[model samples]
Target: MMFHYYAVLAIAALSCSSTRFGVVNAQIVGQFSLEFTAVFKPAGIAQKLFTELSDPETSILQGSILSTSGLIYDPNNVAIKEVAGQFAGGVQPFLNPPDISADGTIDGQCTATSVNEEEGKILAHSCFFNICAIEADDCINFYSGSPFVYAPALDQNQLPPSYPGTIIGGTGVFEGIEGSVEVITVAGREFTSQTSSSGDIAQRIFLNTNFEFLERRKI
Candidate 1:
């Protein structure tokens, strides 16, 4: 099967929970400034549809859904704790290095697993683990596992000049792409600034959104 890779446009902030697959509320948080293109299954009449959708004048709406299958990782490990905290909650106040997993890779006995498909061209997967750590205040907190993208790939022409070749797997699905095509925008505040006392923030998140079209053959 020919898979057309799309770029990872934005990171959506999901609600905190102990469940495996995080929930994606229908809200845009941040904007995606990157630029690129993705082409999937370009054949015969499909080519015309692709051209129309890819056109600059055309407007594309991006959305996503959570995967069913989840992965496994070390929840008790420090690295796992940090990632769990970051994925579940943003950087903690007055906590430098705040146990945030800056790097998107799995850590501490984490493994990726694929879930059974529910519909056509739709697959479910996730990465799960836990974290237990002691704080400076002599307090102990335990964090459960969280889900993230497992298979991220870049489609042809989706990467920009600076980012050449396709990058498969990362925070976002497509490594390259341009212009807020699909993005997660914070609703009430900016990513760098805090607007609420509870530290309630927002992000424009995309989940399992894909596009495919056929290309016309020149005879």
Candidate 2:
């Protein structure tokens, strides 16, 4: 009975101490930047047909998957290579009548490795002129877990020809760390025909990015 009483008291004390420690440790915040380039090479393509509306309505949907490979360069001169598989689908909605403007949304995901073999998924609500973003931008977030766990609060966008992106938060080794990036893109839509390679109707983009990182003072 005496031993049982002491054990119960000891366990309660430890639990209270742990709770207090957690409360004392505050989360950190910061911002930084990085840079690199990602090349998305189309591997296959597919067109989604709307049977009910056989006659041209006001939009068309097309999608494809690409083997993405790239290297990310940081402001501190760190090189991070990424080999990823990305799949995306988008619909080119027509204007009031039937004007095909490059205003649409593309949503997809990519699996790559940097700090670890993490498959980061993203849904970018963006606009583009053919394969290039013209005077528009997008915001995307990424989460990585496996060897290490982290989240790159993403902002992938383009201001006309080039743009900037940033990371707002993270976890584990990347906890309290934030980063930023600059982007310059070269798309196949400008270089190659709209449809090519055995009528696959492919599209590719070379995304060049630069980054920098900073750790917060707390946590």
lDDT for every model? 0.20, 0.24
C-alpha positional error of residue 193 in candidate 1 after TM-score superposition, expressed in Å? 34
lDDT of 2 by residue, 1-219 (tens): 000001122225211111100011222322211222232234422223222256565322222122222221111222122222211111111122223222212223322223221333222212211111122232223322222122221212111133334444433333344434334432221112224322111222222112121212211
Give the range where candidate 1 is weakest over 10 consecutive residues by summed lDDT: 39-48
Highest-scoring model, lDDT: 2
Count of backbone collisions in candidate 2: 13
The local lDDT score (0 to 100) that residue 150 gets in candidate 1 is: 25
- What TM value does model 1 have? 0.16
Give a tens-digit lDDT track for model 1, residues 8-38.
4456533221112211111222332221111
* TM-score, candidate number 2: 0.28
